[model samples]
Target: MLFDGDNDQKNKFIDHSMWNRLINDAKTPLTKGVHQFQVDLEEFLNIEKPNSKRGDLKPINVIKKHVSGEIAMDKLEELKAIVHGITSV
Candidate 1:
C-alpha cells in the first residue's frame, strides 16, 4: 500500500513495506538506536512527523548548526555516519 497516505499524502509514493521494518523496530531502543536518533533529530529540528517532504530542510539545519558551531563537528560526523548506516539498510 502507499505509505503515509493518511497523514502525509505527498509521501504516498513510498511502499509501506519499505519503511515497515524501521517502524516496527523503533520502540525497541536497545537495537534501535538509529531510529531513536531519527526521532530525536526530527524533534530537535522542529520537523513535522511526516515524510511527505522527503527532502526536508531539517538535516540542512543540523549541518548549518554544525558549521556555525552550534553543534560540534564530531557530533555532526556521528550523525552522518548514523544516517548513512540507517539509509543503507
Candidate 2:
C-alpha cells in the first residue's frame, strides 16, 4: 500500500532516476568527488529513519564503518570512474 496512489510507481522511478543522475554526473567538483556509496548510504539511512541526527548512534555507526579516509578529490574521481563504467556497460 506504500505506492497506492496513482502514478506513485512512476514517480518513484523518476525520483530514483534523477537521484542516480545527480549522483553520477561529475560536472561539479563537489559532486564529482563524493562516493556514490556514501550518497546511497545516506539516502538509505534517511529513508529508514527520518529527521535523525547525523551523529546519532545508529547513523554514526553506519557512517563510521562505511565512510572513507581517502581525500575528497580522490574519492570523487573514483566515483566518476565507477559511474562511467556503469554507463558504458
- The numbered model that scores best in TM-score is 1
Q: Could you estimate the TM-score for every candidate?
A: 0.34, 0.26
Per-candidate clash tally:
0, 1
lDDT of each: 0.49, 0.41
Cα lDDT tens digits, model 2, 17-42, are: 45555445644543323334433443
Q: Which residue pairs clash in candidate 2?
A: 33-76
CA displacement after TM-score superposition, residue 30 of candidate 1 (Å): 23
RMSD of 2: 11.2
The positional error of residue 34 in candidate 2, measured at the CA in angstroms, is 3.7
Model 2 / residue 82 / CA error / Å: 10
**Per-residue lDDT of model 1, residues 1-89, tens digit only:** 11122222235566544455546555444543343332356444343443546657656765666567776556667666766776553
| Candidate 2 wrong stretches, greater than 4 Å | 1-14, 29-32, 42-58, 63-89
Runs in model 1 deviating more than 4 A are 1-22, 25-34, 42-64
Candidate 2 least-lDDT 10 residues: 1-10
